[model samples]
Target: MFAPFRPIIKDPALRLAAVLLVLFGAHAATMAPYVSALAIRVFGLSDSAYSAVLLVASVLSVSASVGLGILADQRANRRAIALGTSAMLIAGSGLVLAGDNAVVFVIANALILPLSASIFGQLFALSRLAASTHPERDRPAILSTLRALFALPWLMVLPIWAVVFDHGAPLTAIYPVTLTLGILIVALTLAFWPRDGATRWPDPKSGLTFRQSLREMANLPILSRVVALGTINGAVMLYLVVMGLVFAATPGRGASDTALYAGLLAGLEVPFMLALPVLVGRVSRTSLIWVGAALYALHLGLLPLLAPTPFVWLLTIPGAAGGAVVLTQPMAYLQDLLSNRPGAGASLMALQKLAGDAFSAAVFAIGTALAGYELAAAAGALLGVIGAGALWAMDRRAARS
Candidate 1:
């Protein structure tokens, strides 16, 4: 496990990148799990209203991601961008915490959160650029290690959230804490970010125009295949959007129980993700993805049957394993497909976020309206199975080509 990261730590720049990812990951973990609950409890949003908010956020997030990716590709100062975005994130969190009505919360979610979320694309672009300087075989491992490190804060933060919720603290507690972390992230990034020239992939004498890059990406079969699979993966994520309400409605559970379950599920993913680099060299990436998809199907399929009991939540362990694969493999695969274009990871991620979030919103609205969270989980399971088959077919085609 430590073997893959050894080479990464030997270089000062890679080491700093890894640290920055941890901080960023912590910030992300704090808010993502509770956003749905916050919307319902604090802002009195219904399922459809929350979905609409997400739809708006998704559109804005896509735009920010594309704009940031182009800027990064053009060799703009990523550190400055990241710092400014972090500040925006803090301000967004403040709005969520203090807002007494849905309108303010919607603005924060739709505008500031999407703007802040673009930081992940920027971070991915930066990390891939740094890794480009290293040995080819080591790149996936290095990035996987960074991803695993990201799980660390989730491991710590979620359980603490569980405890806080149990002790009568409001969910709004997460906002202030996340805001503080966001400020720390800004400071750390500004202080330790590699010099602009030091971390960049050598820029081509002439860069592709935004239109050309979009055309190039659209024409790539590998990217299309990955995006198709990623959309199916997004179905699985619908479970999370409504998970808090699902758990609360269960016979013996409430907000604290929901938090604990989320925390445990998140904790389970850390080891799975940490083990991914080791598995990559031994297991084929496509095969790994197929296995993950199958596990996700099994996990989601069981949700309706088992949700009455707390043990049902354990299904997330398999869900986490599946997520560990879906999360790391596609990014690595995308990076491979666009090796010459340093910003392609960002661009592809932006597209994936747009596609995935849109699909998730649809699932949430339709499934909840048709039945409830149980129906949504079942639909997600069916989609995961479809994704697994699609991946198998795509892999075979790639082998033939």
Candidate 2:
């Protein structure tokens, strides 16, 4: 399991890239468990309002990510882009900290969250560049190992966050920590990001329009299938939104419980991620996706029945297994499809986000209104089943072709 990781880390530049990715993951863990709670408790927004904010943020973030991705592909200085974007993200957080009212808070989040969200795409692009340079290393394994590293910070931080939240600490406490991590990420990128010669750029004489780019991507069967599966998987976001709301509304549970559940799920994912080097050779990527999708369906289906109790959260262990495959495989698959066109990776990322965010917003609005969180989760599970079937079909199609 560790064999794949050893070779990649032996190279200094690759090692720093991996460390930066871990810091990025840590930053995400610190915020994810509490963003909704912060909006509600600190900014005094309702659940629906917070969801709306997220929806908007997702849209804006996709745009920023795609734009930045194009710039990254055409230029070799990914470190500079990462550094600048990370600073903008920190600024956004600072604005939120200073906001005195809901309007100010919303504006601050709108500005920062989208930019911050795009950071993942940037990191993915960087990872692809790193892998491309080291042809001897297993690309999928390297990406998977990076993803496994991501789980560590979540595993560590979530429990600490639980402690902080349980002790009646202010939700705002998370911001400063995120700010510090952002600073560190910038520092790492500046210090160790590889600087190859300037990357190839599209001809200005006949530049690729966004429309042309979409058409090109749409023509690829595998790419289209991956995007479709990812869109359907967006239902998972609905489940997440509902879970956060459920935790907030539960009689005895609060931030600490939410953090614990998320931490447990993330912890469970670590082993699976670490095992990816072995698993990648044994299982087809599409098959792994199929198994993952099935697990997602099971996890969501069980949530309504088991939530608000410790037993329900255990489902996250399996859920994490599913998540590990879903999250890591799609990315690796996308990277494979767009290996020669790194900018396209950004487009694919943006497209998936657009689909997921749109579907999630619709599901949250319709499902929550028709019944409640449980009903919404069930609907999400249904989507997971559909997504799973789609992956199976894609596998069959690929095998036949």
Candidate 3:
């Protein structure tokens, strides 16, 4: 379970990469679970507007990710890109805090924050490239471990947020916390992140024009699989979108309950996340992802059904087990799709996010329009299962051919 931590501790590059992800996760713990609430309840956006904000954010985030991925490949300068995206994150946080109004919230969420989201992919790309010289068999473990490191901060940070919110801190306190984290990310990058190819992680420039690079990503095998994983991810996205709302709306539950629920779910997820590498070669990645999708779907579908009672807590079991596989496995699977170009491959995380989030936003909008948050969650669960099956079928066909 802890095997992945060995090299990360011994090697400074791996250590720095690992630290950066933990920081990013800390920032995510604060921001992600609260976005829908902040937009609708605090910032005074309506359901329709909130849905639009999320859809636009997904498109912008993935566009920036794809562009940077291509640029990183050409320039071989993950350091510079990382620094720029970190700055964007800080700026986005500052924008929200400064204006403290719906208009600025819209700009930050739909434009700046989404653009900064590419930083997640950049961190993974840098880590993957840094480990380019490791044995082929060890690569997935390294990436999976980096992902686990990313989830680690959630265990600690979200629980603290839960405590703070319970103690009566304003919910918007997350912005300031996020701002501080972004600054720390910048400091870490400036102080420790290596220059381009400094560690001899060979640059993989395909010498393709911009259009040519995108065309490569447009290939059927890669796109189909990406969409499938994204579909699996959409359920998670929907859970984030509606969890806070459902909890706060429930008579017995309120804001603090929302935070604690998210925090506890995250806490359960970390241990399972650390154990992912052990399953790497023993099972096919898609098979694990498909099974994970089903398990997570069970949790998603049940979350609202049981929200008013203590049994809701049990959802964390499947949530953690499945969350561990889907969240960690996709990183390795997507990266290998374009293994030669580390930048582009890592950016697939962002693209998979784009597809998932686009679906999530649509379901949230349509479901809420037709019914309510419960319907949205159900729609997301169904999509996830179908997506997982589609991915399994696609891979089986490829194998037989």
The best candidate in terms of TM-score: 3
Best by lDDT: 3
TM-score of each model, in listed order: 0.93, 0.91, 0.98
What are the Cα lDDT values of the candidates? Answer: 0.75, 0.73, 0.86
lDDT of 3 by residue, 1-401 (tens): 67777877877778898988898989988888888888888989999999999999999999999999988987778889989988988999999989999999999999998878888888888778777767767777777878877877777887787789888888889998899999999999999988766656667566878898899998988998999889887898999999988887889887777777777777788888777777778999889998999999999988888999999989989988889888988878898899888779977888899999999999999999999988989899999989988988998999999
- Descending-lDDT candidate ranking: 3, 1, 2
Clashes of 2: 0
Candidate 3 residue 218 C-alpha distance from true site, Å: 0.4
Count of residue pairs whose backbone atoms collide, per candidate: 0, 0, 0
Considering only N, C-alpha and C atoms within 3 Å, which residue pairs clash in candidate 2? none
Query: In model 1, which range of ten residues has the least summed lDDT?
Result: 197-206
Q: How far is candidate 2 from the true structure (C-alpha RMSD, Å)?
A: 3.0
Error of 3 at 300 (Å): 0.7
lDDT of 2 by residue, 175-223 (tens): 7888788888877777776554543322121146666655666676756
